[model samples]
Target: MSSSQPSPSKSAAQGPGSPIADAAPLSLSAREPHVPADRLVAEMVPPPRFDSVRFDTYIPDPKQPSQPEAVRVLSAFAAGLGSAPSAGKRRWFGKKAPAKATGPRGVYLDGGYGVGKTHLLASLWHATPAEPQLKAFGTFVELTNLVGALGFQQTVATLSGHRLLCIDEFELDDPGDTVLVSSLLSRLVESGVALAATSNTLPGKLGEGRFAAADFLREIQGLSAHFRPLRIDGEDYRHRGLPEAPPPYTDEQVTRAAHATAGASLDAFPELLDHLAKVHPSRYGALTDDLRAVCLTGVAPVPDQSTALRLVVLADRLYDREVPVLASGVPFDRLFSDEMLNGGYRKKYFRAISRLTALARDAKGLVAQ
Candidate 1:
């Protein structure tokens, strides 16, 4: 695919100087003839443990009643992309002029948590027609991690070849990330890279009460103008069938039983972590919504620094979400070795430990019942 922007060096795509270089490759595609569509979708846009979710299966919350409009907008956007004029199109008159584009350049799907923003974005991505190399899909956290690994200009240059970029969990919790994303969006749109993004916060309201008022307002306004805004009003699908009471035993108890029993397994917790890693890819933000509980058994001391760091991130996500966690084989204090605690992510590890301990105590009380 030809682009007006210069191509980035091979090193840039591979994250030459960043810690995230070791992460899984960020490129995504679904063009293999033999690959099943569902599996391809899972690899391209890993939903929160909902690999099979599609627009057809998305049940709109009746109280909100906004699915029809949302679906219409997305369908039109997908249809428009195929018919939209190329970036180089021009008209001949007394003097040549660029052809005017007919449809919205991009779209912003905004809604509260669990309202199917990711569902809509993934559906649109699956519907768009593009070669495997011409598309990219990931979460906002993953985007930032990429930018950090590859400089902003290099990252944008690499992404410029793509016709579509679908991002989930768009947020503005960090001022630096807010600025970076705003600039990136401007450049990508100018280069004719269409964007489809999902966010819990509306553009105008992004970073409200969190960052400096004027700075956030200016940034959000600039970004919002580039995309047509569509709201998806609905109840959180995640809460649809949740139990009224907590589980009888905490995740820790389960882990302990598995450890004490002659033959037991805590494979589910690791599998859950794997799924979370695929969804976020490079960062742990926005994972709280996807995770509710965990069980860890045969917990030996963590020797790898990177593995320990990941566990810290996982613990933070569970703690922030107030999700119950269970561990056996080794006490919580023994999970991390002294060297691991003293590493670069010491503060985060400390926070995780404190939160996990408290959560475990709460679980013990419930088990006593």
Candidate 2:
């Protein structure tokens, strides 16, 4: 027994006859598997504005009166989206039965600034299925840009593939945009695309005195009829510690900014300004329409007065549109120096700081962590 080596295992004794010995070696293939063209295209599409916003991260502030209602409405909306028909079913059954003939299911969230309207909208967008062709998220400004590029019927045809279309910064300031959006909303709903939108204005009050009140009403009335209005009233979460001051920018500034930015290039802010300056009298409000969110990277102190002024205008435009900004490389408070803030544009610079701080805070809320 002392001299005996450990008995060879059965497989060792069996040698090549063992199951383990006969098995093929595992190896990675040189070529990757093919991805479908549609899948590739889906991957290439720009992500939704609130791609990171999800239900799990949304904490309804227990202290806010409107938080409960917002939570309930968001839950209902998410459930509705999740339970909506799949692409195959939507194509076959939705058309044959025509769901929208009875009226499409829609929700309109009306709330004050920084009350988490965008957060809720982003959450709804994220809750929808990952089929890029079946969902879209953008502001009304971006919608108009699509229409301008693709034309009305083509835009409708393109967006028709989506089961849901979510619009943020919903406003009826521009008569032309109002008409186009109202018509587009109706057509989309009729095509079985559901709508979810957030706005500061009530449906009835949209474009009240700016356009022919009756005409404006007529255009959006049907569109508004489709939605169950849910009011989200809460403190401006962005301005918690700030002193109470009147909004520096007026409704006229907002409308003008929207109109100016509507036609500007959706490329970059500088390019947008260049394009707008060519066509419009002033480029101050030009980037508002297409500027959904702002990200300031390598944000050294603004180098020159011209650059500082441009940034002030950009902040104003962004603030008026209720678009959130994110800054890195420097604190937003340090974006402009004492020299810049002490100039003739001091008040404007101060207002920019105030508004941008709020927008940045709101943007922070949008991040899941």
| Candidate 1 Cα deviation (angstroms), residue 364 | 17
State how far residue 172 of model 2 sits from its true place (Å): 1.5
Candidate 1: pairs in clash: 251-326, 252-326
Residue-level lDDT of model 2, residues 1-369, one tens digit each, is 011123433544554333323222211111112333233224322233345767667666667676667777677676676555634346655455334434437777765556677778777776766465677776555566667656888777777767778787565445767777988888877666778876554323333432222332454777756776666665555566564432223223333332232121112233333433333112233324334444433445666666665566556456656676544445566767887766544544554666777776655532333
Q: Against the true structure, whose lDDT is highest?
A: 1
User: What stretches of model 2 exceed 4 Å from their correct place?
Assistant: 1-49, 84-95, 98-104, 202-219, 241-355, 359-369
User: How far is 175's C-alpha from truth in model 2 (Å)?
Assistant: 1.4
Q: Residue 130, candidate 2: how far off, in angstroms?
A: 5.1
lDDT tens digits, residues 1-369, model 1? Answer: 111222443544644333222222211111011322233233334443334556677677777667878887787787667654334232212334346475567787756545777777877876677665566777666577677666888777777656788876555445777678878877776667788876554323333532222333455557555577676765545445643323234456664443332211234434444444444334343333322344454455665665665676566445444555555545666667776666544544554565566455444432323
Candidate 1 residue-wise lDDT at 205:
39
Q: Name the best candidate (by TM-score).
A: 1
- Please give the TM-score that candidate 2 achieves against the real structure: 0.54
